[model samples]
Target: MKNAQKPDHMSLNSLVNRLKDGRYVIPDFQREFEWSPKDIQELVKSIFRDYYIGSLLLWKGKTENFDALSCEGIYGHQQNGGAEYIVLDGQQRLTAMYYAFHAPEIRLPNRANRAFYFINVDEFMRENFDDAFEYHYQSKRLQRLLDSPKAQYESHQFPLSVIGTGGWDLLKWVQGYTKFWEEYPNTEDDNEDHISAEQAEVYAVNGEQFGQYIKEITDEYQISYIELDQQLGIDKVCDIFTQVNSRGIRLDVFDLMNAMLKPKGIQLKQMYRDVMPNVDWVDTDRMNVYVLQVMSIVLQSYCSPKYLYFLLPGQLKPIRHSDGRREQEILVQSTDEFRDLWDKSVSSLVRSIEILKHPNEYGAISPKYLPYASILPVFAALESHIWTLPALERLDGTRKMKHWYWAAVFTNRYSGSVESTAARDHQDVQEWIADDDARPALLMEFENRMRNLDLSREVNTSSSTYTGIFNLLVLQGARDWISGVAPQFDDLDDHHIVPEAWSKKHLPGNTWHTILNRTPLTADTNRNVIRDRLPNQYLPEMFESSGEESMRSILASHFISSAAIEILMRRDFGPNDFEEFINERQRTITDAIQDLLIHERLDLSPRLRELDLDIERVELALRELVATNLEDDSERIPSGVRQKVQQRFEVAAKKDPSLDPENSRQMSSLLPHFDIRDIQDTLTNKILWPVFSSSFTSKSDLDLKFSQLASLRNGIRHSREVDDVTRMEGEASVLWFDKILTK
Candidate 1:
């Protein structure tokens, strides 16, 4: 306090102007710009969510101090105005804001491409934080979209670059967007590019709403900063800067909340300290914040940072009634109530951690290999809620919780928007537990995601899917080849099945590092038995020692098929043989994942299974028929159909770059991109109808069979509970397709 003035605040609008005016400078000794694109996106999301982004520490510097420190303007800073303050802290936050708002044509640190940020209006309106903010590298496609007014209106993206110039630029862009959409409603021709008057009005309204909201946030949001007096001696300033940088600690939300609770006599810091040791087994530094998150979830069924503030003892929390009415309710009206809730939340967190660590439950083994630590708050809150249910109901709730947990992990649901995801999952899973029919959308999402699951691409040890697969193997009681028993929790290690040493020599790149090629084994077994040798070299030895049946059983526990073992043990084992083994193992893993996702009570009957198989065969037959008939001439396909399929492939390529149309595995045909709906489009195309007319009775008949098959395929794909009558209809349609396509 001797050298620094009290913390003061300014509007975010003023902050941006001051930054552009080059009033604040970074000292040469400060760390370089280090925020990645993801970090920048999160900062933007925080700002829009109205969460505090931390205060800055700046030294009011004299000319001599500036010269001595060798300070310079922030990166991409254009104005040469003399520096008024030398920033000691918050450099990364300030620079990220400048880069995003300024939209400088420069690459991010350690990145090859220049980053561009945009707010997706649709996602923002829907409150989907995960997709609300987006960043993309500068590309021709991006440029074309940005240049086209129609495209921008259709995509509902508001570029953040206009913010740095001034609010006027944004206003003008919004006006232009609204006018363009209004003028081009396309009533004359109802084509793909046309929109109805109703849609045009909606777009116009959204554009104005987006602009006004951004302007309000920019103009009203306050940024706090502490200013050190220039009168302070140079040594004192230098010492202060070093101390601030070296400590690497900031007062986060938990710190602020702790102080807020003190006036209410809650002593949150003391409560957290008492509870921390119990949850110390959870390997994360943000345990304090997680505790608050758990409390938020339990109280309001929401734990986002903004929602956490509602946990204050006297806060008037809004409650919506089942009859479409809302009212204010004091969530924690007294200190005693707050303490009771806190104690119960801590107890629930302990129970959740125990369940996670237990081998038979989630099989996370330890906090070290837990797929997603971020999901703990929701998991704990749900556990607390479930404990309040009747004994018989509690058992059912726990089983469903296990299924939801795996679905969340395999879908990577908590990768971003952790708080929002937590709130939604808590609510959805609770509903699902109470009602058998109220299956959460996440289950269907998981099924769709698993249908596309390719384990060979899961290379990172920290990824949810990668760790999830390992946990699945652990839950399977993966017995070590050497001991023929499950390894101790600490002794278990994920070792490469094909041997990293051999794969490094025979395969290209990091293909050997995939989760498909790795499984749980004892560390001792990895070092002593499967040491740097090919599977063929060592597996045969294991088979002889353990007997073929015992070896197959052990491998089955690892999600390794017997067929894969046979391929690995072939006398002529080579890279191709290795490929076959990996493909088969990937299938085995996929099947296990599918099995885990199925509801125990809603198990598919044999008729439903046959319908699924028949649907797959029909897909393959269509692909072969298209390839044989069209000679793989993609250009001959209808422009609309080709474009739609191309869009699907492009979106798919984001998840797996190998899903390109050029990829040979799709059989050089467009059929792979064709869902049952898309298949209908292709079959009904006027240009291509002649080729298909010979196989089908007529276009109407083709439509009837497809409508039935598509409905049934969707039911299977989405895991919707089906009646016997609907199943019969689906089977009849599948038989019809088999009869027609086989001809």
Candidate 2:
């Protein structure tokens, strides 16, 4: 079978010679040259130190059976039925070594030009080994090192390109050095101006030593290789390649796929390069693996959770009944089928990216904050049906699909176990298209999931999910609070409404990054105009400078309530009043988010009706609680809350001009103008016990129920969608109220 083989040691000189004669070649499946100069420098250092660089694994093949790829240092030539060594492992290291020692110029990662050279070889040998291995690609640094006086005297700065070839001769170099000193003799014995005879002799001796050192490095340095038997099948060769390369820079599934495609004259990497530029929404560097995975998923139809393993050559073996070795099945067989599937997948992906580019639609300006790339396959699956629908129907379908996309993003649908989620969603989408009720059912599922979204707390702007949410909010027509202009998609900045410095000073340990405290602002406004001043000090000045109506428009655009704006305009605004302002703004933001999510007026009546209490009685009870709390003390109500309430009354009166005079009189008579907080506090306090005394066993029990009610009310008022547990607590509170009211 010709299976027995042994490891072979080859010198660098012999390898270079074989490379020159085109006997050594790289296989088509091997990855392209990817090592940086730093990698090459490390290899050279390891060689000089005699450390163990990894062995080269090669496939010995007849020159006629396989065509070799022409690389930087390896070329193609006709062979007369001779054996050629095809590199399977250590392609990167071999390529680096070849280029460093042979190639004149090398192209870097970004297509920048560079050349490699050894600096001060004599000094390199004498100095600390760690510091001796110095190499550079920058032009200015290379030029400076080459032009140094040390380089002139010590024969340093050896260009590696011509080292082993006829272009450079070490013996001739030594003879030239000896002849130069003899022709221009320096007999003055001067230390600086002229070279002394002794210095000249020392230079000659070092030159000879330098020639010998070059010989030792290039000719004497040995590298080991494990050459596989030439008769092994390609599958076995691939398996051996994978096993031997398990430790460092192992072959990815794409590499094996490339190997399979090579026999049919296809390059997988070139295919990627061609398709990537056509898809504008993909970041080439980060999204390449994901793009390949998406193609694999679409072609396979079934979600291979470990797709990399599945695609590996000879990875799937048939079951054996204790009789014989089983033959492996091929996952991908035909090249034409692969090409067709690849074409369809790319076409669908491009269409999906186009769907997200509409300005009035998703408006996905960049891929930086795409929450999940797996959603691409789902959209691609939907594209098959979307194209068949009538124009108007297509528009509607796209809108629904976009809604689902946003929902999945906000809900983190594809976070963990992404492939499993994608597979399930793929089937669900198919069913959704099959049945008419499925669309609304899917949307309801989205809404149900979204109901748990509460932006009352701080959001990390760096999180991809949160970033996508921010982008969605902007797409839904969110405008800057300060400018009254829609923020430029690329230029928006997150600014603290209550400045961070103020919060740290007055409300330490409180969250300063809550959704209510943040607003999208232009970079100029955020950085230049509103530096670190408290809102109370800056907002009033803005109102004065920009006028009341314009300022009101600006605040309204940011979802700030009309009442909150009126409070900010008060001349007696105080720094301590910021907490109340934050609470009010949080409520406004919560309401705005609800509108964005569902695109309809949020109905809490159904949820509230579950309590089965007298509506008028509840309102009257809350009003009475507010009135009694403020009956005696003028200092109890905060000035900001009072001003906000009066502003609401004035604004209401202005809307109905006939009631202006009566509203003025009513405002003067009302001692403490009440807001929602006063009612919430009253409902949560022991003072409300008499209103619901029949429903409770004790004061503590009543307090607990009311506390839960207070929490639910706050969540509802702030526009947060509560979870099932919160809904249950709310229902229980309502039941307690129903019992007391009936009694």
User: Which tens-of-lDDT digit does each residue in 1-743 have in candidate 1?
Assistant: 36357679999889888888888898888888898999999999999988878889888888888878888889878647668989888899999999888877779989988898988887886678778999989899999976875677678777888788897888887888777666654665654665667767776777777778888999899999998887888788778877876756656788889889888877788888888889989888888888888999988898877888888888997778899899998888877887888888888889999988877667788676798889899999999998999875776677788789888998898777688888889998998887765677777677778778888888999898998887777777789999998887789778988888778888998988998888888898999888888887898888888898988888898888878888988887778987788789888888877765443322345566666767888887876777677777776666777777776665555445345436523436356676777667777888899987888759998888888887787666544457676777888888998888767
Residue 121, model 1: lDDT of 81
Using TM-score, give the best candidate's number: 1
**What tens digits encode model 2's per-residue C-alpha lDDT throughout 1-743?**
45445599887778666655556666665666777677777677667555456578876776443643332224223433333777777777776666666654445555566656463545554543444555666588667754653443345455554454642555565455555444446656534457667756665666666667667866778889988887777778777766775665645556666776676777877888888877756543434445555555554443432453344333452445567866656664666666665677778788777756543456564565456665676667567556767764564455455556666776667654355556555665555555433443345555655555555544665454565555655555566556667777578777787788767776656567765667677888887888897667788778788887887777776667778776655666554456566667756755554565454322234454333233324534545544564553433434554455556555444433333435443433333344435444444446454643444457676567666666665555333355677767866775675565455
Candidate 2: stretches off by over 4 Å: 1-250, 280-286, 293-337, 354-359, 390-392, 439-445, 480-484, 566-586, 599-743
Off by over 4 Å in 1: 1-8, 27-33, 56-71, 82-89, 139-151, 180-201, 225-246, 262-270, 315-329, 601-743
The CA lDDT at 208 in model 2 is: 68
lDDT of each model, Cα atoms only? Answer: 0.80, 0.59
Per-model TM values vs. the true structure: 0.75, 0.44
lDDT of 1: 0.80
